[model samples]
Target: MLIEAAGLCAGYGDARVLHGVDLSVGEGEIVALLGRNGMGKTTTVKALMGLLPAMAGRIHMGGTDVTALPAHRRARLGLGLVPEGRRVFPTLTVEENLRATAVPGGRWSLPDVYALFPRLAERRSNFGNQLSGGEQQMLAIGRALLTDPRVLILDEATEGLAPVIRREIWATLARLKDEGQAILLADSRLQAILALADRAVILTKGEIAWTGATAALQADAELQRRHLAV
Candidate 1:
């Protein structure tokens, strides 16, 4: 597995949002983490990225234990995250935002990112706050790509975008998958996930409710209703 977490437990203050979650993303694979709101999907992503400390669990990257590492260390070890809200630096130019956390001598570069999202290239000089929501999302994904992550984790991959932009993002993800990028995606869009992910892991109140191939998840309507219905 490129990224693996076993018995991951975390929370805010004393609130314990996640409980014994186990998930993994292998090389050249796409895994979708699905659940309704407040079900610890984001917490799981944060824990794996080292943004949130694991209360009791183990996280491994390329078979090396990384549970004790900090966020920067995890990034160095090849964990890249596109957070829920597309949190780009408001004060930085688009080019600067891409460079802020970038690791030199990686597979990604400024020109490559710009080519992937030409809109960003067009707005290269604009501050993060100056861009629209979809532009910010593209910038976020581009910034993460610049890290050359072994496992790219995206939380709420496309939450609040126009239909066209959402489709564009999904298409970009498909292209990434084609190029053998290992991705762990947490999103509410079921149909898109089913089409893109190889495997599916469903969560309910922090614990894993069900896990299997995406085909199985798509076929089980009752299971979806039980754990994923809004």
Candidate 2:
């Protein structure tokens, strides 16, 4: 597996939001982190990325135990995160944001990212705050890709976007999967996730409710209704 977290526990301050959550993303795999509002989907991803410290768990990246590593160290080990809020640097231009955390001599470069989202190329000079939500999302994905991460985790991958923009993002994710990139994403769009992800991990109240092949989850309407339905 490119990234693995077993018995993950994390949260903000004293309030724990994840309880023994386990997740893994192997090479060329696409895993969906599914759950309703206030679940630990964001916390789980944060713990894996070392943004939120794991109170009691082990995080391994490329077979190395990275439980003690910080966020930048984890990034060096090829764990990239596009955070839930599309937290791009508001003061910097689009190009600057892409270059901020970029790893040199990697498979991905500015040109490559621009090619993946040509809209970014056209708005390269715009500040992060100036772009529309979808544009900012594109920039966020591009910035993460420039890090050449072995495992990419996107929290709320398509949270509040127009249908057309969401489709574009989904297509981009599909292309990344086809090119053998490992991905873990959290999103509420069940049908889109079902079509793209190989596996699904459902979270409920900071605990893992279910983990299995996406096909199995899709076939079990009861399971979806129990954990995922609004």
Which parts of model 2 have CA positions greater than 4 angstroms off?
A: none
- Candidate 2's residue-wise lDDT over 168-205, tens digit each? 99999999999999999887658889889999999999
Give the per-residue lDDT digits (tens) of candidate 1, residues 1-230: 99889999998888899999999999899999999888889989999999999999899988799999999999998998999999999999999999997788999989999999999999999999999999999999999999999888999988988889999999999999999999999976587898899999998899999999999989988887887743
Worst 10 residues of 2 by lDDT: 185-194
Error of 2 at 68 (Å): 0.9
Give the lDDT of residue 156 in candidate 2: 91
User: Against the unseen true structure, what C-alpha lDDT does each candidate score?
Assistant: 0.92, 0.90
Top model number, TM-score = 1
The TM-score of predicted model 2 comes to 0.97
Error of 1 at 107 (Å): 0.4
Q: Estimate each model's TM-score.
A: 0.97, 0.97
- RMSD values for the candidates in order, in angstroms, are 1.0, 1.1
